[model samples]
Target: MLWLLMTTGKCNLVCDYCGGSFPRDVVSWSVKYDISKLKSTIETRDRSPTVIFYGGEPLMNPKFIMKTMDSLNATRWGVQTNGTAVRMLPESYWKRMNVALLSIDGREQITDKHRGKGIYKRVVENASYLKSLGVETIARMAVTMDSDIYEEVKHLVELGVFDKIHWQLNVIWSERWDFENWAEKSYLPGLEKLMDIFMQNLSQGILIKIIPFLGVISAHFTGGYRGSPCGAGYSSITVTPEGRVLSCPIAVREKWAELGTVNEFRLLEDPLPDYCKTCDVKKYCGGRCLYASNEKYWGEEGFQLVDSVTKKYLRMVISKLPEIEKLIDEGVISKSSLIYDPVQDSTEVIP
Candidate 1:
């Protein structure tokens, strides 16, 4: 099982997509439950689970992270951070981490525009620093209208600091943009070009770890995934600061998302809706995202609009399978190279 421990609900930067920290009313700024209780609860469920530190900015409570890591006998330790406070937790602690996901949306201009000025540089520097320590560093991007997916992703790949790159479209929870126009005009076209680059890299014996493509393609060979690809309600769950276990981490305030308290938690029988099970691409997409499907943040029409992107993305990746197989057959790339992100370390496979 994958356990996402919400270290804190406080954040230093207010990114445009998420709008910074959760309200104190929704989630406490600091942890309210005892650390020993969390450790005991987790031990009862799974002796050595994969633990990932999550938050408004997990680094805000470095003490909590260090304390929890010290107490829990986790199989792996990972953090989804904004990359500003990498130094807060010393090098020794960082070297122990299995993965470190840094949020930087492509290039300096785009990232700074959304996150704030100087955030891009700081994130890149921290990513390089983490990479130097032999930690698996991932450049996580939140794609939006301002983003040119192909260019931004390509730029980050060229940086050579990150071990992998993952992106999620900013579609859920907030009516902010022209989804239809942006999808057709920018995102879809950018994805086509990005797919071309992905195949080119594969043929040249280089796996440019673009997770969305790699994850979906991996599912194609592994008989596909059920429920959420990220395992929101199935294999993965979130522990809030107040000790509430949520099916989806971002579904912070939704009553339906509240599974139970950490001390006495039970998994939902069927977190996904019936419509997801009946979808033609359910096998490949794995219901896209559990929160998005349930919330319907964009209404049915807008929800399907986002779903169209997933369908198109699925087709694009599936279309390249033959060539990818050819590359494998010719010894240009190996099958294992395509097998990535097996565990839900905060990489929502279907962007």
Candidate 2:
């Protein structure tokens, strides 16, 4: 089981897409429950669970992170941060972390446009610093309207600091953008080019950790059926600062997302909807996203719009499977390189 521990709901940066810190009412700025209660709850459920520190920006409460790490006997420790507060936690503590995901949306111009000026530089520097400490650093991108997926991913891959690169589309929650237009004009085309780059890297015996491709391809070969790629309500669950357990971390205020509390954590039996079960691509895409599937914040038309992109993206990857297999057979790339183990790392494989 994967435990997403919300260290705090306070975020230092207010990005255009996420709209900054989570409201205090929705997710409290600080943890209120006793750490022992969380320890007991986790221990009772899974013996060697993987605990990932999550938040509006988890680094805001470094003390909580340190304390929780000290308390729990977790199998692995990871954190999803904006990269600004990496210094708050000491090197010794960071050395213990299994993974650290830093949010940086591709290139400097695109990243700065969404997440303020100087954020790109700071995130890259912090990623390098974390990499230096032998931490498995991931460059996590929130793909937005202005993002050129291919260029940004290529740029980050060239940086050589991150061990993996993952991205989630900004389709859920906010309805400010013209997603339809952006998908057709920018995103889809860039995705095709990105696929080309991914294939080229594979042909050259370099398996670039472009998560979306690796995840679906891995599922295709392994026949692994997942309800949600991130395991929101299935293999993983979130513990908010207020001790409220949520199926998905971003589904903070939604009543449907509320599973239970820290005192008594209960997992949802059938989290994915019926439509997803009937969908042909469910096995590969894994319902895309649990929150988006349930809430449909973008409405039916908008939801389908995102679904179209997902379907197209899936086809693009599946179409290249024969070539990928051929490369593996010819020793161009190893077959084991396609195996992606970070299913519960909030990589959002479908995006």
Candidate 3:
């Protein structure tokens, strides 16, 4: 099981597309979490748990995070950071962290435009520092209409820092948000460019990766359950500051998305909804984001748009598998570098 501790929902930066909201159930950041309840929750689980520190910016509650590491003695831990405030952590903390996912959208112009002044520089520096500390630092990009994935990835490659790169399409929770138009104009093109670059880089011995593409390919080979697009509420669950267990980090504020509390936890292991059963791309998509598919964002047109895009992405990556095999055979890329365990919610490298 993967336990996501939302240390604090207090982020220092507010980007344009962000909902800029936290779970209403959270207590103030000053109040320390009930670590006893958390410890008890972990003790009940049958399998060894993997811990992920999430935000607003998890580093806001540095003491709590450090103490969690001490009490749990968890080595399989990661942090989803905004790339600022990492400098506040001690050497011991950095050494203990296995993965640090630094959020950087693109180049300075693109990242700074959304995140704020000098963010790109700070994040890049932090990513480099994390690498020096031997933590696997991945550049997590939120792809939007304005994003240029190819150029952005190229920039990261030039910086010679990040150990890997992963991206997710920006989710617009507002009913008024026009994702359809954006998908047509920007999202699809950027993804195609990114796919091309991803393969080209691998052939040339660069290990950068686009996570979703890898996830789809991993599912294809592993015969793993691709249900729900992720492990939310199943293998992975998030806990808020107030002790509410939720499906995912983004689903924290969503009222219907709540599972249960730390003490009285519930895992809704329901299969795919009826509407998704007969879709051609069902296995590849595994059902779109469970929280998004709920009534708030579901409409026939919108559903179809997302479905088509998912299928397109799957097909594009599938077509390139032959080339990936070729690269592996030619010794351009190592087979060990590509790994996927669907149940683990992992499509990462050994590094």
Model 3 scores a TM of 0.88
Q: What's the lDDT for candidate 2?
A: 0.87
Question: Which residue ranges in model 2 land beyond 4 Å of their true spot?
Answer: none
lDDT of 3 by residue, 1-351 (tens): 677788787778887667443644553454345787788779777457778787778888898888888888453878888898897778788898888889898789888888889999999889889899998887877766667666876787677787666676665354445667776677667778877877777889876655677666566555644456556677678888777888766775568778888778788677465777887766666666666567546466766676677677677777887888888899998776775543343322100
Off by over 4 Å in 1: 342-344
Clashing pairs in 1: none
Candidate 2, 246: how far from true, in Å? 0.8
The digit string of per-residue lDDT tens for model 1 on 1-351 reads 789999889999998888999998898889999999988888888866889999989999999999988888998899999999999998888999999999999989999999999999999999999999988998999888889998999999999999889998888677657978988898889999998988887789988888888998888777787778788867889999999999989999899888889788888676556887787777777788889888987888889888887898898888888888888899999888777554646788888
Q: What is the lDDT of candidate 3?
A: 0.72
Candidate 2: 10-residue stretch with minimal lDDT: 339-348
- Better structure of 1 and 3 per lDDT: 1
Model 1 gets an lDDT of 0.87
> How do the predictions measure up, each by TM-score?
0.96, 0.96, 0.88
Superposed model 3: Cα runs more than 4 Å off:
19-33, 174-182, 201-207, 323-336, 342-351
